[model samples]
Target: MQIPEFSKEQSALLARFLAEQKDALSLAQTHGYLFAVICAPEPLDVHQWLEQVVPGCDGQMDEQVLFAFMALYQQISEHVFETGYSLPVSLQFNSAQQPYLDMQECQHWSQGFMLGAQGYIAKLLAAPQLASELKEALETAQQSLCFFILDSADIASIANQHGLTEGLLCQQQYEVMNEFAAGFAELIEAVAVNSQLYNDEGWG
Candidate 1:
């Protein structure tokens, strides 16, 4: 299906709406979180997940705005399922923003993803064979969130300790985050397949 591209204007609008709802996650984070949830082994109900992330979404958002968000969700889910990759281009920090703000937003996106994944961690953990890989990916993503918590002094100190420029450190973190996303996508596919096999065997 040809899903409409999630445009900047829509992003801004959603951000504003989320802000009005006193949501902790920005539009970017929310999108990232939802994308992760959609890629889960046994995905959450789309409408239920939407309501959780976007409070009052069904009642408050106009038809057009609601449709746009749903379309974006569907598109991301389909992309991940068909391609075995998350929509990194769409999920990444917006470069047009100031560097500091971009970094902060990236942290928020990671936090949101972690929060989303926590809901399914129990199920994933129950499968001991997959637990270690999923846990490692989650830990790497969690580490990425630490960058936003450091003061300038702390950041500089850490950079110096690593014998790397601050810019290089940030770039390294970005690469790690990308790897985390890819790892997560693989986990999701594995879980989905396992669930299918279990069902096929009438193991329910």
Candidate 2:
């Protein structure tokens, strides 16, 4: 069971993410914002963040689970791509691992990694102390997707009151928007294990 290879577009997108990530990782100004937020201590208004991710959601990340996780990654990736250097991503998934991840796996990328890829990102933001302001910004990124669904007023409120959409805040704060990397790593690992199991069982 060979995992499907990267499409040209996806490779391009990955290159873009890597490049931006590299710059962000290096910049004293915009370093590692996405990585931290995703792994921080669960926020009080977790629903607000989740609401911003999944539209028409009156629940938490754990309630609507799959969409929540996918939305978070999609929004973050979209933002990174939307930046002056967008990437060409593909609609490809490792079919062999689908059933495994979709079934055997449960919970968010953080839980899957048994480590907080987002938390690791936060460390990059502060380099010493993970402050409350950074945490607030992290929530903003998490809710970014759901925020798109709302009209300008509501979105503006979050942005105005909490500095949600402020690039300065997002840039200055910590976030783990790169949870996709963590999720993908687990995806490939699961695919490998599944292929082995299938081989052992004499299945394709």
Candidate 1 C-alpha lDDT tens digits along 111-201: 6676677655555546555546555654555466335445667777889999988766766766666665656666655553553432433
User: TM-score for model 2?
Assistant: 0.21
- Candidate 2 per-residue lDDT, tens place, 1-204, comes to 232332445434433433443222111111122222332232224444334333344652232233333344444444444432121111233665321121111122223222223433333334333345544544444343122234446545656888466433332221232343334323322332333322333322
Q: Please identify model 1 stretches exceeding 4 Å from their true place.
A: 1-3, 56-60, 83-101, 126-158, 191-204
In model 1, the clashing pairs are none
Estimate every model's Cα lDDT from 0 to 1.
Answer: 0.62, 0.33
- The predictions' CA RMSDs to the true structure, in order, are 4.8, 19.0
Error of 2 at 188 (Å): 18
Alpha-carbon deviation at 39 in model 2, angstroms: 17
TM-score of each: 0.70, 0.21
Please report the TM-score between candidate 1 and the true structure.
Answer: 0.70
